[model samples]
Target chain A: MNCRVLLAQIEPTLGNLSANLEMHLAAIADARARGVQMVLFPELSLSGYFLRDQVAEAALPAGHAILSQLCERSRDVSIGAGFVERGEDGRLYNSYGFFEDGRLLEVHRKVHLVTYGMFDDARDFAPGDRFRCVQSRHGRFGVLICEDMWHVSAAYLHFISNVDALLVPSASPGRGVTQTEEPGLHSVRTWNRMQEALALLFQSWIVYVNRVGSEDGMIFSGGSRVVDPFGRVAAELALLDPGVVETTLSADATRRARVMTPLRRDEKPWLVQRELTRILGQLEE
Target chain B: MNRLDIQCELVEQLLVRFLRSEAGKFGFLRAVVGVSGGVDSAVTAALCARAYGPDNVLGVRLPYKTSSPASEADALAVVQQLGIRTRRIEISAMADGYLAPNEVADRIRRGNVMARARMIVLYDLSAEWRALVIGTSNKTEILLGYSTQFGDAACALNPLGDLYKHQIFQLARHLGLPASVIEKTPTADLFEGQTDEGELGFTYAQADALFERMIDQRCGEEQLVAEGFEREFVRRIAARVALNQYKRLPPVIAKLSERTVNHDFRYLRSWGH
Candidate 1:
């Protein structure tokens, strides 16, 4: 099966949902014209990143008119957008809401709330407790927001769930200039290696959609890409500029990589679970 | 491939985009850069010319009475190079108005007063020109507290704050600024013969090398000295960085109430933009 996906690498105005929502609508219209089956935006697409105290002000309920508009647009193209979700528990979560068929389907709260360096996600929003794969009409997609991809186990969980594609949306700040090599950020280079390694390891397509432009002197590196199961870049957007990349992702690539390696078929989750239980039991002593 | 050396073309790309995006956030499409014939100001003006078209940037030359004549010529050269609009406002009267009064005699005090007076002129002109004041102070002077606060340090947005003096020179060359400005010894030019290194008692080249390893790499004091840095040099420089911490930040607010401004209540300058 082939899925036509458009990665909307946008430059969102910080803490302005209305402007960002309008931007989303505009991109959605363009995606619809392009006949994209799935439109994936970067992390915090609706609500911009670095929303310190404004996180509460920007957090939207599921029924908000802004989100409702996105859901309505989903009738033509499935949309996955990041926002500050006001949970039913009255707590806020950094969420990626997947809208399909004119309704809300999944709200993947970012499980890994980065709090170090230039981030303070854990302080402003509640941490998500779990990662659940979304079986979309186009493909089996798993969402990892920014720093979630830093931890090995987050992608491993999606791998166990047998996801066809791991949709990683990011607002990664570009830093660390290279000296001897190319004229690009070290962070962007590292992200490339990470996606390739994960795609090869999991035998899953890695759709890394990152944002562009700057906020409070922090420039988000926009180098969105789709890595095939064979760890080759299928498609990539330009760096440091707002852009959109539309390409077809082949499911056969994943099937081919998995069949050639048979790592998934030979997996033993039960033995790993038993070993984890034993290690925990021993640690309690 | 030195650590202090940077990819000049890459740096220019980032800084130019940064100026455009950061200024656009607040609905500003114009910038006011004070060209002191120094490399920092020249590089800054070049970036603004690129970000907001040359017509949008107004390069103002705020020369005092005693400021070098070569300085004004250099500033004019930069304006011609960038093809931006220019204004020559002799600030000697404004500076002397305050200087001659109260019988100010100290050279450092006189220099500081001149710097602050130039700031006043630049800011007032910024309002009239409908532009943001572009800062010329680079990271080297900023970290060393070699600048007068609210003087040349005042800016609505700074693209040069993170770059060291060496990096600034690199960018100056890449931007193709006037060779006179690029190769001239770095100076605030507050007084007639005052050089930046003369006042700081250390060359920028030595300081930038130490700063990269000390601050960027976070080498401990022992490690700094172990890496061939003079022990005394490390202590004095580290102390200056510690002491000048206040100069780098906004005034501290007392947290008397919950969610006080800057203390607890936090919002970026681009809060809604």
Candidate 2:
């Protein structure tokens, strides 16, 4: 099915949740005007990235009063965004929350904890250990956090399941684009290519939203995209701009792509039935 | 050209010239950055190697008890591929026997120990080897007071200081860095698994673009708002960079005398009689 997806590549400020919420509202309104059915936003769109020790305190429960406020503001369209989630175990996570038809639907916590340079989530936020699908009124949707997309196992499981669309909220940082006159020797465009490749490899329609702003010293170039099943970018929001990119995904277009690719057939059998076993292993040790 | 594109081109061009000029001065003679197996250090290492030759460069991997095995492996990998000399120093005893950990705040004290320890190793190696200490700090980190004053921030010369985090990735690829090194999330490796972005609360691309438009281009917060940016983000970033300007400068002191070191009578050539 072709559904119009709005990718809101916003530049949210660190630690200012209120203003970030307002920007979401405005972007939602703008998406509604563009007749978009669903909107995707960058990870931690409300609180921003690089929260340091503050993430533990700044995070709210998935269904907290603040999330309810965001749900109300995004009443007109299905909005998916990343936020800090305080789970039942009292552990905080990098989570993506979904709101549609004026209610909360699902929240997906990031599974992979990126502990390399310049990232400190392993210190503050606990890594998630689960993956599942949310049955939205629009369609069966799969939600994953930024680093979760990097793990091919997660993508395999999500695609093999009933999810028709995958939504990813990211704060992927990279260098700015290179100029022709400049030697261009200092350019690294692999991060952009990585996202695109992941979308295609999954063979699921992707709505990747990224934040644009400088936090601490990391720069998140906002090159949000809406990719088709074939991995082609249907629409894109330019990097480093506080703007929205919208594209209509009709049910017909989705059907056409699915029929042409039939990726689900190849992907279904590969779904491992080892999830329970893994959880059991974790519990045992 | 679109004004934005033009500005991007201009900034990119300036970065190239700066890299070239820096390399011309330090490449063959001496160029080095401490490779902590982090993205920033890795990028700096690659740039230094590219500016000069790999044979002329050096990689120092200083590990403590808490340092990950992956860091040593990765650091060695970069050195081997780049064909640079490698030095592995275990500073656990030095830290444990020399410093009093109980009296210091956990994070700051750990940072101090790590920075000073790493600096001592790098400079000592630099002195014995006749190489310069290449700095790995990027502009966004420097602006936010996110780095140690004389620790990781101190360098004989730095080619990556003016560039932001996002730009380092670009340069990394252009310099043909190993995919593993280029793709890894940036981290200081101070802890078991510390990443630069997660602690900072924002990504490098956004920060670099924002810095470029606001600080480098001198665009006002109002302009960013009109451009559809979140006002709070603009204000907060601008404010943080402004507040942290001290981290980017030499130490400041009140001037009561006529011939203060930096402010007045600052003639380095005339100092020698």
- Pick by lDDT: which candidate is best? 1
| Model 2 docking grade | incorrect
Model 1 lDDT, residue B80, Cα? 96
**Per-residue accuracy of model 2 over B19-48 as CA lDDT, tens digit each:** 444334333366656887766777777666
Candidate 1 lDDT, tens digit per residue, B1-273?
Answer: 677778777787788889999998888999999999999999999999999999999999989888999998999999999999999999888888888978898998988888888899889999999899999889888999989888889999999999999999988998899999999998888888989999899999989999999988989999988999999999999999989989889998777876799867889888898
Which residue pairs come into collision in candidate 1? none
Cα RMSD for candidate 1? 1.4
Give the alpha-carbon lDDT of every model.
Answer: 0.91, 0.72
| lDDT by residue (tens digit), candidate 1, A213-247 | 88889988899999999999999998889999988
Using all chains and alpha carbons, the TM-scores for the candidates as numbered come to 0.97, 0.52
Interface quality of candidate 2 as DockQ? 0.02
Q: TM-score of chain B, per candidate?
A: 0.98, 0.84
lDDT of 2 at A124: 69
